[model samples]
Target chain A: EAGVTQSPRYAVLQEGQAVSFWCDPISGHDTLYWYQQPRDQGPQLLVYFRDEAVIDNSQLPSDRFSAVRPKGTNSTLKIQSAKQGDTATYLCASRGQGSNERLFFGHGTKLSVL
Target chain B: GDQVKQSPSALSLQEGTNSALRCNFSIATTTVQWFLQNPRGSLMNLFYLVPGTKENGRLKSTFNSKESYSTLHIRDAQLEDSGTYFCAAERASSFSKLVFGQGTSLSVVP
Candidate 1:
């Protein structure tokens, strides 16, 4: 089975620029999640979707960040007018519906804000 | 409040040594997962657990729900094993949405 896939392995943008990251999850997975990893830090949940419906996004910077999984199969996370603090690695992961299912992660997109 | 806490913020070990990384959660975590982010910034799942232990080659992980802690032990550490290790816990109310620890950076030098 193919693991979660993400596009644009690396990105560089100046302040106020915009960037979008795409994710295609594994087949037959129901839960998709987005996490942000700062340099030398753990991955923090930004948002999540369960079959095209957002399950939670309280941690997300909703003002400048948005995510959608329209078909429950693929997802996109967008950052508008990015700031210096927005520079991080965006990681996408997917897992089946279960209490303890393993999550498959994408390689992630490294974003640099200048 | 942070639900998850990790220890040994960083460690350095020589090749052929062993080390353990730990995570403790404050919430009622029913499940735990471990991951390794390599130098290239790839997050790879190492283990997922629910109050038990699982081993794969040189990596072994254990999660004790009752104790609200999890551990990842690396045996015969190698250069490739050096990376940032993160442990995440799923609370009952979160419905599998995991809260992650700060992570432990391990360096195994040959």
Candidate 2:
């Protein structure tokens, strides 16, 4: 089975610039999640969606960060105005519909804001 | 609603040795998962547990919900085992929403 796929692999932007990360989840998976991992740290949940509906996004920075899963299969996360502190890796994961399902993660998009 | 605390922030072990990593939870979770983030930054699922133990090759994991702790034991460690290990928990009633730990960095030397 193909694992989750994330793109651009890496992104470098300047402060105040806008960047978007894209994700393509695995087939037959209904639950998708987005996480941010700072250097030397664990992944932190930013948002999640079940099908085309968002389940939770309380941790997302409403002012600048936005995500959408329009077709329930692919997703896009956008940062309107990047900050230097925004340098980190953005990960996308997907899993089957179950409480104990194991997560399949993508290679992640590493963003660097100068 | 709580968090996971992983122990021994970092560890170095000699190849062919055995080492154990732990995760302590402050929340009331029922399911737990362990992942290894490799040098290239890919999260590899190692084990998923529910208040019991599971073994795969030289890796074993146990989750005790009552005690709110989980452990991962690596036997005959190999150089390929160098990476960061993370444990995540999901609330009993939820649908795979995970609360993750800070992660334990492990390096197996030759």
Candidate 3:
């Protein structure tokens, strides 16, 4: 089976610029998640969706970061007015709706804000 | 606030050796998962447990709910096994949300 797919494996942006990351989750998966991983740190959940409906986004920076999983299959995470500190890897993951399902992660979009 | 603690923050092993990584949780977790983030920024799922044991290849993992801890053992470590190992605790009642540990950085030297 093909794993999750992400676009722009690497991205470089300047402060105050904008960038968008895209993800195509595994087929037959109903749950999608977006995580941010800083250097030398673990992945931190930013948001998640269940069939086009956002399940959680409390950790997301509402002011500049936004995500949408429209059609419940593909997702896009955008950051507006990016800050230097916003540079980090953006990971997308998907899992089945059943219990104890393992998440399949994409290679991730590595963003570097200069 | 739900916390997952991973031990042996950093470790180095020689080829053909073995090592074990652990995670202790303070939350009401119903399941656990182990992942290895390779150098290319890919997370490979190694094991998923629900208070039991599972083994694959040279990797074995055990989750003990009674003790609120989970363990992952890598046998006959190889250069390909060098990476950051992370354990995530999942709460059944929390709608599949996961809390990840800080991760254990492992290095295998030949």
Candidate 4:
């Protein structure tokens, strides 16, 4: 079985540019999450979805970051007018519908904003 | 304040040795999960626990919700064990999100 998959393993963008990261979650998984990891830090939750509805996004920067899981399977996280501080790895993970289920993570997209 | 605090931000261990990593949570959590991010930047699940201990090969993890802490032990460490270890907790208030610790970078040398 394939794990969670993400596209554009790496991205380099100038400040004020825009970029979109895509994620394809595991099969039959009901929960998908997007996390941001700066260098030397652990993954921080940005947003999450159960099916097609967002669970929580309070930690996300509403002014620039937006995420959507339209079909409940694939997800997209877009950053509008990225800044140098946005340089970090975007990780995607998915888990089954259970309190004890472990998360399956994807090969994150490393973004660098100049 | 850090909701999840990891101990010994970095560590160096010789092959075949053993070491333990710890995470203390400030938030009330019910479950905990441990992951290892390899050099290639892929997060691999190591253990998931609900106030109990689980062992897999040379890796063991224990979660103590009452104490608001968790631990990951790597025994007989190998070169392939070199990576960053993270401990995440599922808060009692949150629906199903994990609050991760800063992480413990482990390097196993020959």
On DockQ, the candidate that comes out on top is 4
Q: Write the per-residue lDDT of candidate 4 for residues B1-110, one digit (tens) a residue.
A: 39999998999999999999999999999899899989988888998899999999999999988899999999999999999999999989996879999999999999
B20-85 in candidate 3: lDDT tens per residue?
A: 999999988899999999988799998878889999999999999989999999999999999999
Docking class of 1: high
CAPRI verdict (incorrect, acceptable, medium, high) for model 4:
high
Sort every candidate by DockQ, greatest first: 4, 2, 1, 3
In model 1, the fraction of reference contacts reproduced equals 0.83
lDDT minimum window of 10 residues, candidate 1 chain B: B35-44
Q: For candidate 1, write residues B2-94 as lDDT tens digits.
A: 699998899999999998999989999988889888888888888989899999999999998888889999999999998899898888887
Q: Which lDDT tens digits does candidate 3 get at residues A1-114?
A: 889999989999989999999999999999999999999988899999999999999999999999998799999999988999998899999999775699889999999999
Error of 2 at A105 (Å): 0.3
lDDT for each residue of candidate 1 in A1-114, tens digit (9 for 90 to 100): 788889989999999999999999999999999999888788899999999899999999989999999889999999999999998999999999755579889999999999
**TM, every model:** 0.95, 0.97, 0.97, 0.97
In order, the Cα lDDT scores of the candidates are 0.90, 0.93, 0.92, 0.94
Q: What C-alpha lDDT, on a 0 to 100 scale, does residue B8 get in candidate 2?
A: 81
Model 2: per-residue lDDT, tens digit, A1-114? Answer: 789999999999999999999999999899899999999999999999999999989899999999999989999999999999899999999998764688889999999999
TM score of chain A per candidate: 0.97, 0.97, 0.98, 0.98
Q: Classify candidate 3 by CAPRI docking class.
A: medium
- Writing each residue's lDDT as its tens digit, candidate 2 over B1-110 gives 23899998999999999999999998889889999999999999999898999999999999999999999999999999999999999866666678899999999999
